[model samples]
Target: MPQKKLMLLGGLRYLLPVIEEAHKLGVYVITADYLPDNIAHKYSDEYCNVSIIDKDAVLRAARELKIDGILSHAVDPGVTAAAYVAEKMGLPFQCSYEAACILQDKSLFRKFLSEHGFNCPKAKGYTNVEDALEDVGFFNWPVIVKPVDSAGSKGVTKVTDKADLKSAIETALSASITKNCIIEDFLDKVGAQSSADIFTVDGKLVYPAYSDQLFDKNAANPYTPAIEIWPASMEQKFQDDLTAQLQRLFTLLGVKSGIYNVESRVCSDGKAYIMEVSPRGGGNRIAELQDMATGQSLIVGEIKKALGMPMDDITAPQYDGVWCNFILHSSEEGSLVSIEIDPEFKSKYVRDVGLIVKPGDHITPFKGANNSLGTLFLRFETREELDAAISNPDSWVHIKLK
Candidate 1:
């Protein structure tokens, strides 16, 4: 049999594990993006220089390379392109191109949820600032203004007053690839918001996982997640209810087998809302953390599915212990610095430390997930320990800037 060829869109470090898993399965991996210096390109078997957001360009490259499969794992900008390419080439993908488009755009997804009777915020999408400014009265006070197509909270803003809506809309539009933005009712969550990866097989959701997403209130963008703890503190009843609703949403969209990044929340209104669902691995190595906590490899499953190969039976995760992925970030922009972790904490709870920037490298304030310095994988014997440590992370984890 010929060696299978898999084309991956984007060159972020998140693709490293996907490349490793594909290699383990004896598949040829091609990493494609406009950046030749991306770290993932160094690890991939081959690199193709093409803008992943340009679906037609990617399709031309894929055809020239004679690729067998394609994926846009952990890369939000390429999900639609991957789906488009897959649909055009008859390759495996999580959903149809239309579905990917709807899910990738917050405004479209919100409309879908509303149309289908899923709990969602009152939201509206606008391509022009004039239209959005005109519709400010459509949303309640303290509404969230964000890009319809951006992720990692790059351009998310909370507007408590009408005077600030215009600036927020401009920020969101600047971050948006399509020059579009959404203004939505801010759903006051009861507790920590949930962001994690879930898996589906043949359009049936078989594995569901949730995490307590934390944020640094002092960060430049407070909406960006700073820490994610598995076994979400959300009540089991709510999780079950959300799962059922999620399955129904997928069924309505005709979603197929693949890993999906889902962001949900239990709002103060005594209702659960599914905020976002994208047909790709989430940034922040969410799938990787899920594997560490549950001993199941969504990475392998995703690769196999992308290549039209059989996947392992993916069941609901059974977490053995409390796990947390602490995103390493600096609060200010500066030159080379060192990250410090208390010796006792490092020895006891810290399982792995993945640093993206080295000492002396220029660092910037934590504006988005892309500005993060690294990640710390941690395991705790109890949730109490996890909570105490995370509550006072400065006591143990410190990033010294010069």
Candidate 2:
């Protein structure tokens, strides 16, 4: 048989590891992006300069290359293109084009969740400010106004009073790509950021990881705070119950196989209010963290699932390692002075250090994941060590923004 070919959509920064993992597994990888400078572009077997949003362009390129399987692990914008190609070619894809559209559009996703009996915050989508403003009172204090078609918290605002609602909606809608946003009840009642990333083999739920989430609340509008932990601190029973609910979602959504990343807030009452679910791997180096914590790479799992391989080989994590990732961000948007990740900090537990910022480079406060300076991936023997390391960013590298 010929070597399996993997087609990836999006640039290299976030998608690089997926390419690296594919190459490590001896798969022929093709990366597609509109820009030639995309990080993954250099590493792939073939690089195609094509717009990710143009489904026809992506499908044409995939056909020309005769790709074996198509997948985009961490990038959200590329998921629909990947799905379109996969569906057109009869290739193994985790979701349908309709499903991808639903997930990408917050309004549609909320409706779908409601139809399936999942508890979602009351929300309304609007392209016109007047329409959204009409239902301002629907939400109690601390309402969340966010872009309908944005991710990583871009244009997301928490309005605690009516006076701020209109401004927040305008701000969110202005930043939205679709010129629309959904206003929803803000569930600020937090406990842990728990997520269940599950895989189903032949329609059977295999493994689910539900862990507490840590975020930096200070990040800008579109860029919600970044995550910092996995295999989160939570009761085992909570995980099991959450797993059951996720399995039902998978079944309801017709997600038989492939990777699914679902975000939620496990309230103090232990209820998992569904936040969002992406039919792709977690972004911001979470895939690498998952591998470090579980001994299974989501990149490889995605490839295997696409190739119709048995899922059992890479199903669960073997080690009880704590996985944490932090995005290097600036206090203000400007120019970079210096990013100093000390050389003396190398250890077995520290799996990877990626620094995308260079001295003298112009830097900006993160507007979204796009503005992030870099990322850090860590693996620890115990939770205590992980907590200590995460709490002390002083010991970690610092990027001086001028």
Candidate 3:
């Protein structure tokens, strides 16, 4: 039999392992990105200079190359384009273009959640700044303003006052692909479920992943997720209940066979409200963490699912490990003086710790995930150790950015 040809939408940094795994399984890998310098572009059997969001161009390449399958994991924006090409090419990809459109649009997604009786924050979409400003007072104070179709928290803000509302709306709308954004009622008690990647091929009711988020109150000077730890610290029964509920929600939404990075927040009364669901792997190295926690690679599992292969051969482990991630965000903008991380601590359940900024590089306080300098990955035997290391950054190492 011929080796399967897998055409990946983006390049290596993340999708590399996905490509490597597929290649290891005797599948030919073809990668494409607008940037030829992308890390993954160099490693593929064939490379193309193409925009991932440009559906026609990607489809043309896939068809011309006679690709057996097309996939993307890290980039959420590329998922729809990949799905479009796969569906048009008569491949086994999940998610319809309409579904992708809806999921990509935060406003539309919130509407779907509301219609389905899921716990979702009150939100409304607006086409321009004026419309958003006029409708601002409809929701309570401390509204969340974010772009309708953007990721990595590129243009997200929370406004508790009228003066900041207009600016926040304009900022969010400026970053929107649709020239629109959503204004949501902010929940004071917030928590997010970073897991929701693994699921049964057809049922949509199977467990994917369930992770707890960690925030750095000092990074942005307010509060945002500086890290995320998975297999959540929640009670076993709570995890099971959440899984069952989320599975049912997915089944209701007709989702199947793909990895999803879902975000949700817990209300003051302990009700978990659905935030947004990306039909792709979680960002910030969470997928790798999920692998360590479950002993099953979520990306590989997704590939098996997309390929329609028998997945029962691989089983998720019961003994979960602690997976931790920390984002490096500067509190001020200046030249990178130095990062003093002890090399000896590399093996101390610290899976990976990388500082993307080097000496002489300019660093700025992070406004969002895109602005984050870098990330650190750690695997701990106990949660206590992980917490201690995260809480005491000085103990871990002094990150000195001038």
Per-candidate local distance difference test:
0.94, 0.75, 0.73
- Deviation in Å, model 2, residue 319 alpha carbon: 3.9
Ranking by TM-score: 1, 3, 2
Better of 1 and 3 by TM-score: 1
Pairs in clash, predicted candidate 3? 12-40, 198-208
Query: At residue 355, what lDDT does model 3 achieve?
Result: 55
Candidate 1 segments whose C-alpha is farther than 4 A from its true place: none
- Per-residue lDDT for 1-402 in model 3, tens only? 877788888874777678778877777888888988887877788888899889998999888988887777878768888878877987766577677777778999889888887777889999888877778568977888889988777778888888888888888888876688899998876444444355456655455456677666666634456778766665555556556667766676666576777776566767766677777776666676667567667677777766666664334434356777777787788888887666766667667755556789988887777667777777778878777887777776666765
Put down candidate 1 lDDT per residue, 1-402, tens digits, no spaces.
999999999999899999999999999999999999999999999999999999999999999999999999999999999999999999999999999999999999999999989998899999888998888778787899999998889998999989998899999999999999999998999998999999999999999888999999999889999999999999999999999999999999999999999999999999988999999999999999899889999999999999999889899999979999999998899986689899999999998888899889999899999899999999998999999998988999888888
**Tens digit of lDDT per residue, candidate 2, span 1-402?**
788888888875777778777787788988888898877888888888898878899999989988888887777778888888888998888878887888878998898888888877778788888888788667665678888876666788878778888888898888887798998877764567665465656556675666566666565543355556776676666666667776777677676577877776666554667688787887676666677668666667788788666544546545566777777776587778887766655555567778887878887766677677877777777889778766777686766776
Displacement of residue 133 (Cα, Å) in model 2 is 0.8
Q: Compared to the true structure, candidate 1 yields what TM-score?
A: 0.99
For model 3, the stretches where C-alpha displacement exceeds 4 angstroms are 190-196, 221-224, 235-238, 312-319, 354-360
Candidate 1 structure lDDT: 0.94
Better-scoring candidate (TM-score), 1 or 2:
1
Instruction: Report the number of the highest-TM-score candidate.
Output: 1
